[model samples]
Target: MKALKKSIYAEYDVHDAFQKIVLLEMQSYDGTKKQQLKAFLEDMQRSGCISGMISQFIYHADCKKFYIEHLDDLEDIRKEIEDCLGEAVKDRYGLPHYTFMCWLCFEEYCYDIYRNSFE
Candidate 1:
């Protein structure tokens, strides 16, 4: 996907946007990959291809070593915690199913609208 092929700065920009929504709405992202997983989980309920999404998010976060040589988004770091949690929950049901799905859809829709507006 073009999004996956994009640079870490692009990924970071997306993550930062996610962080803003999470913070303004009291969402969580405890400084780990767990946030991505959480986003994927919610997405799975709707897309059913969350594993790929989760993988993409993880790769994006992991690539920070290459893209981010100085500072990280403070809110994004917090949300990453769920990315860590997502790893442990792959075999469990601790993830929020429906709410996460709604959130994922809303986030994606918002992202598309925002992206379109920018262009």
Candidate 2:
């Protein structure tokens, strides 16, 4: 993965940093390589690196790649998410993709949404 010098949410608040990090990581996948991204998410979930909530959310959001413009809707949930993830989300600077997954898991805790599977 290429190092992200600056992020899409660089001008935004620290709470939105996960959006930027997710975007940077998504750069590795394109429409043609969506399967690889999906598989990676699935494996991460299976290995307990990502929670079931995040894995389901990704599938529901169809996040084969990141959508920079869609991050606005997530703002309302940011603080709740940060709080749920605690120290894992403290630093908005240079967070890796794996860490971002932890932040993503906060969505479930924040919204009280849980799904057994993405299907």
Candidate 3:
């Protein structure tokens, strides 16, 4: 039983999760912030930056004003995300540069090639 378990985790390469502030804003995407949302999506598409499935929502926030303040910072943050995800995904799928998945960091899922087992 122990030997079997050791074999399973030898290869694992991605798992990324972080507390996101923009997720709160995305919840109301269909409603009031439609215009802003359109612009944000278009900008990302044009820049070939952050693009992926954004589901599994959990928000407990209430604000009369939308989160317009981060408009400037959003581009920088998304560019970082794009860099991390890399262009490999685009080449693999033969898709446009704007297409991407929420792949976690490499270290978290990297296979320990040298290790016989994680002792």
Judged by lDDT, which candidate is best? 2
lDDT by residue for model 2 (1-119), tens: 12122322234443254434434444455553344334434444454323433342344244423323334434434554566567334434344443444344433322231122222
TM-score of every candidate relative to the true structure = 0.23, 0.27, 0.22
Model 1, span 63-114: residue lDDT tens: 3432343234423433453474564223133434332332343344334433
TM-score of 1: 0.23
Give the range of the ten consecutive residues with the poorest summed lDDT in model 2. Answer: 109-118
lDDT of 3 by residue, 12-111 (tens): 2111121232234234556444444443334333432223322321111211011132222323444544666684323354432222122221111122
Which one wins on TM-score? 2
lDDT ranking from best to worst?
2, 1, 3
Which segments of candidate 1 are over 4 A away from where they belong? 1-94
Candidate 2 structure, TM-score to reference: 0.27
Which parts of model 3 are misplaced by more than 4 Å? 1-32, 50-100, 103-119
